[model samples]
Target: MSPEAIRKFWSLIEETQTNILLTLDNDALVIWLSRQLRREEFLKRVDTRDLNAYISERLPLIRDLAQERLAYQSHSSG
Candidate 1:
């Protein structure tokens, strides 16, 4: 994904206030993004415990919003 898209994804995560991530399926895409966002470099920049909790709590919601955004972009550009 583009940097702007990635930024927006994280922004969505930050905006959400639910635990959708923990309830979602543990598929490749979810796992990959979770691992990427949880890297040592990124974790070091924030409160590790809080960040993990926030991401786990919001990932699914963030994914849903990201997909919606992508679909909108695709349709608009076509």
Candidate 2:
């Protein structure tokens, strides 16, 4: 993937709602991310056709990010 594509992908991940990221199971999360990345606006901003492969490869990291975010939220709120 191009550096720009990688940056955009992470940007999309960061922009995604925490609930969606945290609540969805792996399959559902992949579906959700696929749909999101396939949207016209996303496509217009970045070429994501090649990103499908990256998504599966990075899913574990994505889930880890969600867990970290949840922990941070809990810690901050407590």
Candidate 3:
């Protein structure tokens, strides 16, 4: 993925993390991420198949990162 796409991916992850109600199962999360990625202007030229594949592959890592982020935030705040 390009730098812009990577940035946008993290941004969306953070956004999702912030919105607790947006928590979704693995399959639904992948679909939601793919849809969000497609809506990005910077990612418009990228193939949908590639984007979906990329997100699917990284979903576990993404969840880990988001969980870590939340833990750190809660720890720091508390």
Where does model 1 exceed 4 Å of error? 1-45
Candidate 1 vs candidate 2, TM-score winner: 2
Q: Would you list the clashing residue pairs of candidate 2?
A: none
Clashing pairs in 3: none
Error of 2 at 21 (Å): 1.2
TM-scores of all predicted structures: 0.44, 0.76, 0.75
User: Against the hidden true structure, what lDDT does model 2 obtain?
Assistant: 0.77
Candidate 1 lDDT, tens digit per residue, 1-78?
335445744764554433443345645345545555655354445544554555566656666775676677679999
Alpha-carbon RMSD of each model: 8.5, 2.6, 2.4
Ranking by lDDT: 3, 2, 1
Q: Which 10-residue window of candidate 2 scores lowest in summed lDDT?
A: 40-49
- Compare the candidates by lDDT and give the number of the best one: 3
Candidate 3 has a TM-score of 0.75
Per-residue lDDT of 1-78 in model 2, one digit per residue for the tens?
A: 667656767888988988898788887887788777666354545444456667878898998897888899899999
lDDT of the candidates, in the order given:
0.54, 0.77, 0.78
**Candidate 3 residue runs with Cα over 4 Å from true position:** 18-22
- Candidate 3 lDDT, tens digit per residue, 14-74? 7775444137877787777888888888788888888888888887788778778778889
Give the winner by TM-score.
2
Q: What is the lDDT of candidate 1?
A: 0.54
Stronger candidate by TM-score (1 vs 3): 3
